[model samples]
Target: MTDAADAEVRDGRDLYVEHCASCHGAELQGQPEWRSPDKGGLYLAPPHDESGHTWQHDDSMLTDYITRGGQAVVDDMNVSFTSGMPDFGMVLTDSEITAILDYIKSTWPDRIRATQAQRSQDAWVD
Candidate 1:
């Protein structure tokens, strides 16, 4: 990781606590029954851990989703899904967003991180 990312990851812990922990969980475990939809038919927030599919996404997708909000990103993709996640672009700086992602990536096991890194590379190649 770059020094800035290291610093962001370090600082992101507190930022996550303040902004993301309540819904995403203090341990990044996500909400209960996250795969199931609620009465309103919205799926609960998914985990950011190895058990979750967060690592399946490339960095640009992840960062864009965070910066633009899930709904907007989905809309841009012409996908027919609703996301309960709100936009953070108005609230967070680009560095802070990267920091939060770095923090989340920091939690993954090495193998998973490598896979995700490869996926990111593949995305760029495509």
Candidate 2:
């Protein structure tokens, strides 16, 4: 890859650490009991690694979640629940958000990446 590409990947990692690591985990491991809701009925942050369902989503949906936050997205779907995720659209540019997501995608294995990429493509078609 070119130097500019390398820098962008580095920037993505840095952005993820700065904005997402606290809740998601420094290594993208996510919080404990992530599948379960807390007493207050809020779900914990799920892992971004291969073990989690991050790969199951398309890029556009993921982008919307990050840009608008889980609450707003779920609200749009008419889901009855609160989200712990915060909106980053005001704080981060669209490119920066993409960087963070790119960083997350970088961690997955080749098959996982391919699957997610296909999902993204399918989403565009749908």
Candidate 3:
């Protein structure tokens, strides 16, 4: 990779550690009991790794979720639910968000990455 791309991924890793590690985990392991909701009905942060459903989503949806937060997305879907995830729209710029996502994507295996890329492309086509 080029130096600039390397730098962006590094920056993304740093930003993710600073902003997301608390709930998501330093290694992106996510919180415990993440699939189950709490007593208050809020779901814990899910892993960003291959174990989780992050790879199932397209980039645009992921970007929207990051920018708008889980609650907004749930609300848009008209679901009666609450989200512990907070919006980063005001806190991070678009490119920074992209970098953070890139860093997360970098950890996935080749097959997963290709699948996600196709999903992203399909999203745009649809």
Candidate 4:
């Protein structure tokens, strides 16, 4: 198999189908009532598109969210308890992860990308 750098993620639409469509919806619209919590007080999967707060994080953070899963890295069991997002470290090869990430980056508009880039840079300082 080729390396992550060698692999091409193509574009957001394709990536969304492979990596996110099952949970997030084919159009990145996420689940219905995604913002509202479930009966267990757990939040449903939220949208990754413009309507979502996904733009709040930078690329690295997003990567960590994928690799480590937000709950694991955040030191919060509650987050994990509520979050349906799974850890892909064992499931996805590094290159696949990178490609998925690239796909996510492709989805964002320039402004969001720039903002995310800056946040990722700031993370390096801490």
Given candidate 1, what's the lDDT at residue 58?
Answer: 98
Deviation in Å, model 4, residue 44 alpha carbon: 1.3
> What's model 4's lDDT at 98?
65
Where in model 2 is the C-alpha error above 4 Å?
none
Clashing pairs in model 2?
none
- Candidate 4 achieves a global lDDT of 0.71
Worst ten in a row by lDDT for model 1: 1-10
Identify the candidate with maximal lDDT: 3
Give one digit per residue, the lDDT tens place, for model 3 in 57-116: 999989999999989998998987788989999999999999999999999999999999
lDDT of 3 at 110: 94
- Shift in Å, residue 74, candidate 3: 1.3
For each candidate, what is the lDDT? 0.89, 0.93, 0.94, 0.71
**Model 4, 1-126: lDDT tens per residue?**
245433465643465587778998776778989877789866777887767877787666677778877567555534345666778887677666667766666577888878777887888777
lDDT of 2 at 109: 98
TM-score of each: 0.92, 0.94, 0.96, 0.77
Comparing 1 with 4 on lDDT, the higher-scoring candidate is 1
Candidate 3 has a TM-score of 0.96
Ranking by lDDT: 3, 2, 1, 4
TM-score of 1: 0.92
Instruction: Give the alpha carbon lDDT tens digit for every residue of 5-107 in model 2.
Output: 7788799999999999999999999999989899999999999999999999999999999999999999999998778999999999999988888888988
